[model samples]
Target: MSGIVVFGAGGRAGRAVTREARRRGHQVTAVVRDPRRHAGIEADGVRLLGGDITDPRAVALASEGQHAAVHAVSPFTGPERGFAGLDPEFFVKAAEALLRGLTETRTHRLLAVGLFANLKTPDGTPVLDDPALLPPPIRPFALAHQAGLDRLREADTPVDWLVLTPPARLERDAPRTGRYRVGGDTVPDPATARLSYADLAVAVLDETETPRHHRTRVSVYT
Candidate 1:
């Protein structure tokens, strides 16, 4: 069984992923802002601990001694910043903290939950290339995801890292058949619509154990 550190256990995707990972027979450490608030989750086999994604020390503490980490922290939460408001400082700093923690612990694999904006059209154009196309609060985060992908690409660490892109749809209540498709870099068929959060978790765990896609980006859809 793989040992995992989930960076944002209280968030939607993070919660889904952590539970799914547990269901798949992996050991999980559920890192949250307040462990006491998540007593139910904590009791259900996750080792819950308080953590702040913006703080490297907290991130490192949470990231330590795990086989790999899933960066499922909701990257943005604002109305004005649009997609542009995804704080680069917060994400980049958190990444640095994670890297440090993993390096110190000598952990090897890292699978990141990248935004769909990191994907490119068949013509090599970005989906979020225009300001008008972006949601007022989500644009910044999409850009931050793009920037995070670039930094991850350039990181020459000893660990193996993979950046996986999830569909733009954030429908938490969607059904999941545990079946989906995965691709690299190029965008998937946008015409098909949203993917369930459960399917996304399946894809994440599949990549976590397989190691077939390393240090590159994989886009997932259903």
Candidate 2:
């Protein structure tokens, strides 16, 4: 069983990934900002560690001795879920911290949960840039997500990383069919933009066991 550390384990995507990893009999560590808030993350054979992904030292300590680290951290948004509540700096800082932590902990692989907006359409245009597809209010958050992706792309580091971008409609609590399609850069289905978080976790773990994308992004959808 591979030793895995999941950052932002309290989030919807993170929880699903953690559960899937454990179901597969892997040693899973759920790294959260506050362990107290996520008491349910504690489970048999699962380790819970408290840390902030924005802090390099914290991330290093959490990542130590792990085979792979999954970055499922997202930006902190407010009620508006718009520009006013968007904080892109969080993602950028977390990306930097993950890089530092991987280097320090000797964790060679990283699997990041990326944004669908970063994927390009058939016309080679970023989906986030299309106003019709993405509302104005959510554009800032999407752009911020893009910044984090840029950090991973620009960083010259030894860590083997793959950013897995999900479809626009990521459904939580959906069944894990373990059936999905993977594509590069382009959105697999513009009309049917949907994917289950459970399946997304399956995709992330599949890549962890048999990595196919390195220092690049891939799209996954049902």
Cα lDDT tens digits for candidate 1, 1-222: 878988888887888889889998999988888888888887678888898766767766876778888888765543443444345666676667667777777778887787776677667767687444355456567766676777777877876888777767756898778988887776665434467888888888887888888788888887
- Tens-place lDDT digits, model 2, residues 64-119: 89999999987553325545655667678888999998999999999999888788
Per-residue lDDT of 10 in model 2: 92
lDDT of 2 at 8: 84
Q: Judged by lDDT against the true structure, how good is candidate 2?
A: 0.87
Task: Please give the TM-score that candidate 1 achieves against the real structure.
Answer: 0.89
**TM-score, model 2 to reference:** 0.95
TM agreement with the true structure for every prediction = 0.89, 0.95
Q: Model 2: which ten-residue window has the lowest total lDDT?
A: 76-85
Q: Where in model 1 is the C-alpha error above 4 Å?
A: 75-86, 130-133
